[model samples]
Target: MTLPTPSTEIRPDLVLLAGRVRTGLGSAADAAETDGTGRETLPFDAVAVRGRHIVAVARRADVDGWNTSAAEIIDLGESTITAGFVDAHVHPLSGAESRHNALMLHDCETTTEVAERIAAFAAERGPEEWIRGFGLSFDMFVGHEITNEPFARAFGGRPGYLLLFDGHSIIASPRALERAGIDGTRDFGNNSSIEVYADGTPTGYLIESDAESLVTDLYPRMPVEARVTAVQNKLAEFAASGYTSLHQMNMEEGDLDVLRALEESGELPVRVRVSPLWRASDPWAETLRRMIALQGVSGRRWHVEGVKFMLDGSIDNGSAWLFEADTHGGGLEPYWTPSAQFTHAIHALAESGVPTATHAIGDKAVEFVLDAVQSLPSHAANTRHRIEHVETIPDALVPRFAELGVTASMQPIHAFAQRADGCDMWTTLLGRDSERAANGWRIADLDRSGAIVALGSDWPVEEFDGRKIFAANVTRHRHGSDRPAVDPHQALSPERTLRALTRNGWASIGHPGEGVVAPGARADLAVFADDPLSTDPDRFAESRVLLTVVDGQVAHRDSSLA
Candidate 1:
């Protein structure tokens, strides 16, 4: 099972991971092999790393063949060594900011409960301090109006702003609206809107990026030092959870400066590939030129290489571009005023050798993105394209991903937002029992269709725990919820789940050689307390990440190992 090595004469700094190893070979046939005995004889027990690259994958008995004079070797008893998980979609700078500055309301089940948490959070802060909150689920307002009425008394007239869990919308208190001078609705030139009542009284519900930005743009920025530390701490959490690289789907205003700050101190924890968003209202030609110029923009451990387009927003917030309007009479419009502009932007990015990752959550948005990619010239075929959040589509759209060579970057963990009885915001909007609701998060369907199905946490929306993401894919169960699994038929097997999290993540980015334990690959590996391919879903989800190695250096190690 040992791979051929150069020779013992070649001595290099080594990080030998000892345990069961998933060596990037196709998992099913390569899971086990034997020499006329019951013992597994497939992957070598250890993979040796030298200077940010794996030097050799060999058995433990061959240690004396090389001089082991100064090598940091970790002996993980029975842990599983595999390619470190890659998050295909994330929002680093913004997620870090929310984790540090805002009160979290994700766990609150009812509006009253949310109000209590907000009131408690605001009570502890000075009146001058802005009342901020994130992860407010839309389901709490299902039967009630989505206005500031429920939480108004709690904010106590402070400049309060709350971000919806979907990230496409916000709920602004009266004082907050006044602080931003948003007295009435104005033209955003797209689907973005400020919700108002019969007499043009602002209802404090802001939908889509343009409308949400009106209030968010006025919020105070964190100090540079604070931002850097916040980001660093969050990436550390990612590494500890077994993530080695993240494709940050959207870039924020000061992302470059914050990333530079981390790079200056050599504190950037994991590799991040950032893609700046192409806002709908931005001048098309000018923005496309700027985005093309931003490709390959790099720091020590991060780069800007792709553009993110929002063909539409989230279904939960009723901003998704659906074929049929939701029960609320929303979801028929694309984020872009005319969907054709999105297609033009896609074509422009592709022709310039720039890859694109479009945020398309609904059926129409996904179809439009696929149509745009299909319409590209043959010369543009070499450029990579990814469709993020393919939440739901009819049967016909499933196989188009493979045919078009588009990477399907999905977050199976997002099923947590749904209830068993189809009462969650997303399900209820699409007619609780509709076929579209039943088709949400088709991880298995796309994977079976031969698409490069890359999985991600979509952190800040979902928590960045890799185990939860992995388990959610297979178990089909919502995190910590007693409800039945969402569309159990769409669940992925454990083997398929690992590949989607690892190999396909790199393949989606058009890098075929990475995300493996082969000798010449990058030295990014994860050591899990349980085999990531374990059949016991509950145990796997709760398993600890004993150690994580990045660039031949230990990014995380469990205290238990020490």
Candidate 2:
């Protein structure tokens, strides 16, 4: 397909030539007209950017149509260029600090390894300060009992916390739990729990959001200056990986202030749209007022215009609010008590013109969120409320996503992390037989139902690598796991996956018309070493990001590109 020529000559700030630009073809039906390849092939080979907006997209030799001499021209040599990726869901400050400074336990496979890593971390810190780290997977203690005894010994009485890879669980040192004054006596309601032994003693493992907060709230956070630097570094890392925008989920007031400082200082490297977390316990009216006040803060590259709420917990941790109990007998735990409180929160957010992105994973939680949105007054139809991580849903509820204008914000890497193989934690949690697949992310099913799908890596929960997400979306398997494809039929095409990763990501974050490379659109482009549109999943790891442009400025460029 081709675009019409501009009526007058244009002067651009930058001109990229000889590139295979994957201009996002509109929707599923538009892609249907293609040769079943799941994308429309645009004929453009060059893009002209003029001060944060694309001025023209046309053939490589058509540079004369614009003021070529005024623009900084770069010959891409037939490289692949797409709209810079927009990660729809991320925890910027927490994930950034963890990635750079946290004592990593990502390589550990057993409790012994976890203990050794913690011990080493404590030794380096001299047992005086709190030890914070992440990246312990579920398989580490699949059949074995979970114990913090070794963790306590390693910490040598100093406080320490080791968060599971899922972020829904945490293992605390015994001293930390003691300092928190959390005996096995207090009830954490249904949504959160402090794991206890047979005789009613705390086990040091805290599950779900509330339980994890017990230890986390006491652990001193990084100073504001340090956190700001960490987030800045993380943004640089993201730009280097080709991300131009990030939808920061669950930002606290402090975090928002830090981000604002960065933006004001002209240090932010990418566009950030944030949703201040909505705490249910706060009075609804006050909560709305606070969010409204926060929403007023906006900048050229940073904005706060949405609210985030959690409805349920992770499925693998048995906190998912499923309609049916799993084979091991666990199901249905809403974060908000009485469930109506949760519904009320969503309705209020929508009515107030603030879009909401909820964390709901189970079929029941998904259905409940949809029902809440459905009950909104007719005029609230444009709410664009989203359901984050629609991991499990019945066939009947899939179409309602489009019918009600709810975006399905999903993480493709999650399905890859938890394959349908009998060995994964999800399979064991659900006890999936041959008739059922436990690792159903339903991307294809949702697409077939005409739903808008936005993709992201939950970040600290998983490695937030765009190529890994691409590899997972196309292969339906983990990056290095030897397991077979979970359900290969659910695998998406490269074009569709790219759209979800880029354009759909913007839509999910309440920013529309910003994900494509076209006239009047934001000049956010990602340059790759090869044509990912035609590449296989196996070769995705070989494709490198050569450059990333945000708002007509070079945010990240490989040294070789110079």
TM-scores of the candidates are: 0.97, 0.93
Give the C-alpha miss distance for residue 489 in model 1, angstroms: 1.2
Q: Which pairs in model 1 have colliding backbones? A: none
Query: In candidate 2, what are the lDDT values of residues 241-353, reduced to their tens digit?
Result: 77898888887547777777788778477888888887655667788788877775787788887889888887777788888776557766677676898787777766778
Off by over 4 Å in 2: 26-42, 419-421, 434-439, 510-512
Q: What is the C-alpha RMSD, rounded to one decimal, of candidate 1? A: 1.7
Candidate 1 per-residue C-alpha lDDT over 1-562 given as tens digits, one digit per residue, 9 for 90 to 100: 5666665553558656566788776764345777566776655777778889888877677666666678876788878888999999988788898668688888887889988988999899888678888889898888777998888989987888888889888999888999888887888877888988888989899998888888888888888788889999989989988888899998888898889988887746688999999988888889988998889989877999889988898998888999999999999889888778888888888888899999999999999999999999999888999999999999999999999999999998787788876667888899977899888888888989999999998988888788888888898886576878877988898888888888889999899789988777888889888887754877787788888878878888889998
The reply for model 1, stretches above 4 Å from the true place, is 4-10, 35-37
Best by TM-score: 1
| lDDT of all predictions | 0.85, 0.79
